[model samples]
Target: MAGLWRKAPSPCIGICKRPGGICVGCGMTKADKKTFKRRRSKGERKALFRILIERLDGMGRLARWEHVYRRRCDRKDRPCPLDKL
Candidate 1:
Protein backbone atom coordinates (compact mmCIF):
# COMPACT_ATOMS: atom_id res chain seq x y z
CA MET A 1 0.00 0.00 0.00
CA ALA A 2 2.81 2.36 0.74
CA GLY A 3 4.16 1.75 -2.74
CA LEU A 4 0.90 3.12 -4.10
CA TRP A 5 1.54 6.45 -2.47
CA ARG A 6 3.30 8.96 -4.70
CA LYS A 7 4.45 12.45 -3.94
CA ALA A 8 2.54 15.09 -5.84
CA PRO A 9 4.69 17.61 -7.70
CA SER A 10 3.98 21.32 -7.54
CA PRO A 11 2.31 22.56 -10.72
CA CYS A 12 3.89 25.99 -10.63
CA ILE A 13 5.80 26.88 -13.78
CA GLY A 14 6.87 30.15 -12.12
CA ILE A 15 5.24 32.57 -14.51
CA CYS A 16 2.91 33.78 -11.73
CA LYS A 17 0.65 35.92 -13.84
CA ARG A 18 -2.59 36.51 -11.95
CA PRO A 19 -5.12 37.65 -14.47
CA GLY A 20 -8.58 37.77 -12.88
CA GLY A 21 -7.08 36.11 -9.84
CA ILE A 22 -6.18 32.98 -11.77
CA CYS A 23 -2.59 32.43 -12.73
CA VAL A 24 -2.14 32.40 -16.48
CA GLY A 25 0.97 30.31 -16.09
CA CYS A 26 -0.18 27.35 -13.99
CA GLY A 27 -3.90 27.99 -13.70
CA MET A 28 -3.71 28.20 -9.94
CA THR A 29 -5.33 30.97 -7.95
CA LYS A 30 -3.30 32.81 -5.32
CA ALA A 31 -4.92 30.81 -2.58
CA ASP A 32 -4.32 27.57 -4.38
CA LYS A 33 -0.63 28.35 -4.81
CA LYS A 34 -0.30 29.15 -1.11
CA THR A 35 -2.33 26.10 -0.08
CA PHE A 36 -0.18 23.88 -2.30
CA LYS A 37 2.96 24.50 -0.31
CA ARG A 38 1.26 23.78 3.00
CA ARG A 39 -0.75 20.82 1.82
CA ARG A 40 0.44 17.59 3.35
CA SER A 41 -2.21 15.46 1.73
CA LYS A 42 -0.98 14.08 -1.56
CA GLY A 43 -4.56 13.53 -2.66
CA GLU A 44 -5.38 17.17 -2.13
CA ARG A 45 -2.42 18.27 -4.18
CA LYS A 46 -3.23 15.88 -6.99
CA ALA A 47 -6.84 17.04 -6.98
CA LEU A 48 -5.77 20.64 -7.14
CA PHE A 49 -3.42 19.93 -10.02
CA ARG A 50 -6.19 18.11 -11.84
CA ILE A 51 -8.54 21.04 -11.44
CA LEU A 52 -5.84 23.46 -12.51
CA ILE A 53 -5.10 21.46 -15.63
CA GLU A 54 -8.76 21.53 -16.59
CA ARG A 55 -8.81 25.24 -16.02
CA LEU A 56 -5.70 25.71 -18.13
CA ASP A 57 -7.23 23.65 -20.86
CA GLY A 58 -10.27 25.87 -20.84
CA MET A 59 -8.02 28.91 -21.04
CA GLY A 60 -6.20 27.43 -24.06
CA ARG A 61 -2.91 27.43 -22.19
CA LEU A 62 -2.75 23.73 -21.46
CA ALA A 63 0.02 22.99 -23.96
CA ARG A 64 2.35 25.60 -22.56
CA TRP A 65 1.65 24.60 -18.99
CA GLU A 66 2.03 20.92 -19.77
CA HIS A 67 5.39 21.47 -21.41
CA VAL A 68 6.85 23.41 -18.52
CA TYR A 69 5.21 21.22 -15.89
CA ARG A 70 6.65 18.09 -17.46
CA ARG A 71 10.09 19.62 -17.25
CA ARG A 72 9.53 20.61 -13.64
CA CYS A 73 8.45 17.08 -12.82
CA ASP A 74 11.54 15.74 -14.55
CA ARG A 75 13.84 18.02 -12.61
CA LYS A 76 12.18 16.92 -9.35
CA ASP A 77 12.27 13.25 -10.47
CA ARG A 78 8.52 12.79 -10.18
CA PRO A 79 6.20 11.20 -12.69
CA CYS A 80 4.04 13.81 -14.35
CA PRO A 81 0.35 13.25 -13.66
CA LEU A 82 -0.42 15.06 -16.89
CA ASP A 83 1.24 12.31 -18.92
CA LYS A 84 -0.83 9.69 -17.17
CA LEU A 85 -3.98 11.57 -18.05
Candidate 2:
Protein backbone atom coordinates (compact mmCIF):
# COMPACT_ATOMS: atom_id res chain seq x y z
CA MET A 1 0.00 0.00 0.00
CA ALA A 2 1.16 3.55 -0.70
CA GLY A 3 0.09 6.86 0.68
CA LEU A 4 -0.31 9.98 -1.40
CA TRP A 5 2.23 12.70 -0.70
CA ARG A 6 3.78 15.59 -2.55
CA LYS A 7 6.79 17.80 -1.93
CA ALA A 8 6.14 21.45 -1.35
CA PRO A 9 7.60 24.03 -3.72
CA SER A 10 10.65 26.11 -2.86
CA PRO A 11 9.71 29.62 -1.69
CA CYS A 12 12.59 31.44 -3.34
CA ILE A 13 12.32 33.86 -6.23
CA GLY A 14 16.01 34.91 -5.92
CA ILE A 15 15.45 38.61 -5.08
CA CYS A 16 17.03 39.46 -1.76
CA LYS A 17 16.03 42.66 0.01
CA ARG A 18 17.49 43.50 3.39
CA PRO A 19 15.04 46.28 4.18
CA GLY A 20 11.94 44.10 4.15
CA GLY A 21 13.79 41.47 6.21
CA ILE A 22 12.12 38.91 4.00
CA CYS A 23 11.51 38.23 0.35
CA VAL A 24 8.65 40.44 -0.80
CA GLY A 25 8.13 38.37 -3.94
CA CYS A 26 8.58 34.68 -3.05
CA GLY A 27 7.82 34.97 0.66
CA MET A 28 11.02 33.01 1.40
CA THR A 29 10.83 33.00 5.18
CA LYS A 30 13.99 30.96 5.60
CA ALA A 31 16.70 32.62 3.52
CA ASP A 32 15.37 36.09 4.27
CA LYS A 33 15.24 35.82 8.06
CA LYS A 34 18.32 33.82 8.90
CA THR A 35 20.94 35.73 10.94
CA PHE A 36 23.81 36.04 8.50
CA LYS A 37 25.01 39.62 8.75
CA ARG A 38 28.66 38.61 8.72
CA ARG A 39 28.56 35.72 6.29
CA ARG A 40 27.02 35.73 2.84
CA SER A 41 25.94 32.21 1.94
CA LYS A 42 22.92 30.09 1.31
CA GLY A 43 21.08 28.84 4.36
CA GLU A 44 20.72 25.15 5.09
CA ARG A 45 17.40 23.34 5.42
CA LYS A 46 17.51 23.48 9.21
CA ALA A 47 18.08 27.23 9.23
CA LEU A 48 15.31 27.68 6.73
CA PHE A 49 13.04 25.54 8.88
CA ARG A 50 13.67 27.79 11.86
CA ILE A 51 12.72 30.79 9.80
CA LEU A 52 9.55 29.05 8.65
CA ILE A 53 8.59 28.44 12.25
CA GLU A 54 9.12 32.06 13.15
CA ARG A 55 7.12 33.24 10.19
CA LEU A 56 4.25 30.87 11.03
CA ASP A 57 4.16 32.24 14.56
CA GLY A 58 3.67 35.74 13.19
CA MET A 59 1.65 34.87 10.09
CA GLY A 60 -1.47 36.80 11.10
CA ARG A 61 0.17 40.20 11.28
CA LEU A 62 2.36 39.52 8.26
CA ALA A 63 -0.57 38.34 6.16
CA ARG A 64 -2.61 41.40 7.08
CA TRP A 65 0.20 43.73 6.12
CA GLU A 66 0.76 41.92 2.85
CA HIS A 67 -2.93 42.23 2.03
CA VAL A 68 -2.96 45.94 2.78
CA TYR A 69 0.13 46.51 0.67
CA ARG A 70 -1.35 44.57 -2.21
CA ARG A 71 -4.51 46.61 -2.09
CA ARG A 72 -2.55 49.83 -2.04
CA CYS A 73 -0.56 48.71 -5.05
CA ASP A 74 -3.68 47.81 -7.01
CA ARG A 75 -4.73 51.40 -7.65
CA LYS A 76 -4.46 52.49 -11.26
CA ASP A 77 -1.50 54.67 -12.26
CA ARG A 78 -0.18 54.62 -8.72
CA PRO A 79 3.07 53.09 -7.51
CA CYS A 80 3.12 50.80 -4.52
CA PRO A 81 3.34 52.64 -1.23
CA LEU A 82 6.20 50.38 -0.30
CA ASP A 83 8.11 51.62 -3.33
CA LYS A 84 7.97 55.23 -2.17
CA LEU A 85 9.60 54.43 1.11
**Model 2 worst lDDT window (10 residues):** 1-10
lDDT of each: 0.77, 0.39
Question: In candidate 2, what are the lDDT values of residues 1-85, reduced to their tens digit?
Answer: 0010011123333344434565554345453434333222233433543454456346443454445444644533344323322
Give lDDT tens digits, candidate 1, residues 9-57. Answer: 7788889989699999999988887777676655666677779889999
Best by lDDT: 1
In model 2, the Cα lDDT at residue 47 comes to: 51
Candidate 2 global lDDT: 0.39
Among these predictions, the greatest TM-score belongs to: 1
Mark the regions of model 1 whose C-alpha exceeds 4 Å error after superposition. Answer: 1-6
